[model samples]
Target: MNIETIISKIKNALGEGVDKVSDEVEKSQVFEKFEDSDDKVAKILDDAGKALTSLFDTIADKAEPMIKKTKAKIYEGIFEEYRKDGSPYGETHEGFMQWVDEHETEIREKVDDGITKTRETILSGVKKTQEYINREVSKKEKPSDSVVDGSSVTDQKSSDKE
Candidate 1:
């Protein structure tokens, strides 16, 4: 049954058995128990939340440099597209670096979008990883008697000859 019903039953059982205190005292006691339970749950949730936030902050900090490096690599490829043609058509190294510096917002959005898409794709594959492994394992053929368990190939071959 629900928590409230269970608490009510407990309160009733307490009221029927106890004679020293009145109904108000029993209820107050039950309420106090509930408050104590709620406080414990809240504390646990608060601690978990803090830990999760810290983990995310740590991941973001570690990812920041890697993200900038990837963005620069992408920018270089884009810069190369214009450079292959030569002259004013392609951006000079300084011009390309300036462009990257100036378009920070756009670059960040693109990088974030790439990260989100990559995460989604990876998670989708991860969910099926166990199933894929199980399927492949099941499809494998069993070993013959000549290939005894724990025996080396040379030993198995000699035993087979015998």
Candidate 2:
């Protein structure tokens, strides 16, 4: 039914029946060999995992300060310059507000001029558009009794007279 029984029967048929102690010894040796190899594989894997973890940790620890320093440098270069010089605008919020106050009249004049010009241009365009629409509507509304079915207003009138 099982491998051991089959082996035993075959051995017995060959007149070399297996001893129980010998079978047990062989099974124990094979089991121990398997266990030893398994332990070895587990140790190797554990060591490899620890080494990889340590490598990544070391890389992260070394890179953190450099990354922070780079970010600080970039911020300093861009924002610090703007804070100092205030290019086309102003340096700070108060400075920007003061600049706007100083130029308030000029800004208002330019905006008013732009709006007036835009309004005049739009009014002229609208007048021209309305004239074109009116011409088209009048043409369609005016009656010319030129019949599409080969009869005219004069022909119908003459027929009625008859």
Candidate 3:
């Protein structure tokens, strides 16, 4: 559910908790935020590509095999160079996006796998932390004397101190 629906529910539940809050919530607008620096970089790269293609086409002789070969070699050198990670065109965000787009299914599967692994790791850590806290708390809580006697432990400890 959107923030508007949540606000509406809160408004009805609160009834008249704060009329101004309800009115402000009713008039509130939600903005969609994204961190798509990659997309912006991709767009710039696409513009650059168009510019390069335009330059290549400006050579009025369009039918020469040598020109075609040279263009293909240049394109290959630019887009097919293998990076340290063994991925072609992975050096640039735009090129990496292109490679990912081409291998979308594989990349998506790997991403899902990574998320699952990460979730499992987090859950394991949380469980261990919870167990550690429980153990520490149990140690600190020393079996209350109240369990044996009729009085509470705090009273027993205060009486013993006196």
Candidate 4:
């Protein structure tokens, strides 16, 4: 199945478990004894559970695509290395060792390039998300300010009437 489907299944399973536990806790005698204490305890448990769930969701969201990309790159690198030697494996034990030794620099370069590109891509995405959020916040604030300004004008007009 696809990553999104897998993630959704995981989330649903976790949500069901959370709901079951919450229901059990709500039904307990301990919760019946002290209403205020039960309220606070329930709130704390709910908040902590939600936070943990969110953390796992974030991890899964980030890891799925990264794992796929890394797997593809590793396969590509191995295949390309094999092709260069003109053999599926290697010519000989010594030949394999020599190939590895010779390609150390190139392999390192490719890994470094991949890391740099991945970092830049993640950063760019974060920047774009931040910009979008900021734009939305500004849009919301402008309407709020307009409402306050209108109220102030109405208040001043009333004062001037007096």
Candidate 5:
């Protein structure tokens, strides 16, 4: 039965014990308090879950268009840079295939040029990084003493020992 019906039954069952009615009522009130607290906890958790989901959806919605725009800009830049020699690439898949077929030599040259430039740039950067690292390592190394004709300390010591 429902709580109110159970409470009413309890009250009726304890009729002559009316002096103890306050104790029964107190016990029921405590149980009702617990039930109310549980409902509040559940509602708070549900609200927090909904709020987090909404926040995630909002972030995704905001990012989608910007990501598309960035991708478009990168493609545009690549096309503009590579097609500077009046190439007839029309920014479509069919057009691109046709252009490739028609200007195979020019396309190959441009591709090779791009590859060469990229390799040179990477190699230059690597060389500079290596030089900087070597300089730093040399600076950190201890100075050697007792060097004769550009020989290291270990070699000199070994000769002396021999």
Candidate 6:
């Protein structure tokens, strides 16, 4: 082939190679852009999730006291209704209520004393059980007097026979 034709062919091949390389670079850039966008979307979603969780937490915090108050009111209403329907210990609810009101302090003291005595009795029982357990465990852990003194039962029996 002539030099000119050879040179033109080489130039054409180089140009095609450069075009392919450019296309590949463009494709890589597109892929990188998609990855960046996906990361940004994920970050935004995470932030939104966090914000929603915070909002719910704040709502619960603010609503908790109100819910408690409402529950207390409902319980009070139920008790009041029961009282109106006459849950009295004596003849006439008013007299029963008056008697209870008069002896409220004494009743509370008695109840408290009973609770304290019961707690003391339970604690005493528990302590006795613990002491018993400790004694039993210590007996098991210690060597017996016969074993410590190096006298086996058979040796003692033979000595007694002699």
Q: Give lDDT per model, in order.
A: 0.67, 0.64, 0.62, 0.66, 0.67, 0.62
Candidate 6 shows a clash count of: 0
Candidate 6 overall lDDT versus native: 0.62
Model 6: clashing residue pairs?
none
Model 4 — TM-score against the truth?
0.45
Query: Model 2 TM-score?
Result: 0.32
For model 1, residues 67-137, the per-residue Cα lDDT tens digits are 89887887665566446534343356776666667666876787688779989997989779978977887
Which window of ten consecutive residues has the lowest lDDT sum in model 1? Answer: 142-151
Per-model TM against the reference: 0.41, 0.32, 0.31, 0.45, 0.35, 0.34
Question: Could you tell me the lDDT of residue 105 within candidate 3?
Answer: 84
Task: Give me the overall lDDT of model 1.
Answer: 0.67
Give me the runs in candidate 3 sitting further than 4 Å from their true place: 1-93, 142-162
Error of 2 at 118 (Å): 50
- Give candidate 1's TM-score: 0.41
lDDT of 6 by residue, 60-101 (tens): 999899879866765455445446657555456675567557
The better candidate by lDDT, 1 or 4, is: 1
Better of 3 and 5 by TM-score: 5
On a 0 to 100 scale, what is the lDDT of residue 120 in model 2? 100
Regions of candidate 1 where Cα sits further than 4 Å from its true position? 1-35, 90-162
Per-prediction tally of clashes: 0, 0, 0, 0, 0, 0
Give the better candidate number (5 or 6) by TM-score: 5
lDDT over C-alpha atoms for residue 135 of model 5: 88
Better of 4 and 6 by TM-score: 4
* Top of the candidates by TM-score: 4
